[model samples]
Target: MSLGLAGVCLALVTAAGATSGSVVFVPVLSFTLAWTHSIEKVRWEEDYVVRPGKTPGAAPVLEAVAARVRGSGAGMEPPPDARLRHGWYEYTPTLRHPAELRLTRSGFTADYDWCTGGRCRSMAGLLPSNGGVTVLTACRSAPP
Candidate 1:
């Protein structure tokens, strides 16, 4: 079954790999000004994160979606910080349990280190097309 946009993986289908043939685009925030909190701090921010699986190599597709989402906001005035970002968006490969990755942009980037207990290392960095996810499982990496 489809989990819709459960957590950050968005609409990850119940299959893994780029070969799965059932790739799906998870939910993306169309509007900005969302609230976020963490040990670091809490505040409202403008950003959108696309939840893509961790199979790797899904960045291109996710980026395309992000462009569309950003495009929707075009013809209007950009926020003060829009100049610094490509599209106020990023792709989340996976969201660890209990250690939730909230709606904060920093949270997404920091989770890379926190979720891995600092031992987590990405050889190629956060791309997209992660291990397929189903209703039974959020986007999960094969347990080591």
Candidate 2:
């Protein structure tokens, strides 16, 4: 019963993120639910390649964003079983200021451009060298 309710919540969240066209990061359980719900996770992390003319390297930008997400502590823990199953997801953001970047579990990547102060420019692609990476908590039931 609880699992069912959790599944429903997970579906709603994943749908919301997908339809909104923004990257969303969720804990492992919610990610698993997204898959069960048929919402594909984008792999922006691995698929992104630095285009010849692109400003910043794709790898560095992704690493920076991943670091930022990790540091932000957003969706760090898997929700209780009563809330959802275990898995994690990454997607692009939906803002115009900072380009939306997405990464799925399968290594898909999506990039969007944005405008700033009247000038069109890609938002800071990654965290500055000073920004630290977020530490994700391990799955409780997983083997260490």
What candidate 2 gets wrong by more than 4 Å, as runs, is 1-47, 54-86, 94-144
Q: What lDDT tens digits, residue by residue, belong to model 2 across residues 1-144? A: 111111101111132343322222222221111111113332111112111213432211111111111111333432232121133333433321222233222222222222223333222232111121211111122112
Q: List the candidates' TM-scores in order.
A: 0.19, 0.15
What does the lDDT read for residue 9 in candidate 2? Answer: 10
Query: Cα-based RMSD of the predictions, in order?
Result: 15.2, 21.5
For residues 45-73, write the lDDT of model 1, one tens digit per residue.
Answer: 33233345455533211211121113223
Worst 10 residues of 2 by lDDT: 3-12
Best by lDDT: 1
Q: Best candidate per TM-score, number?
A: 1
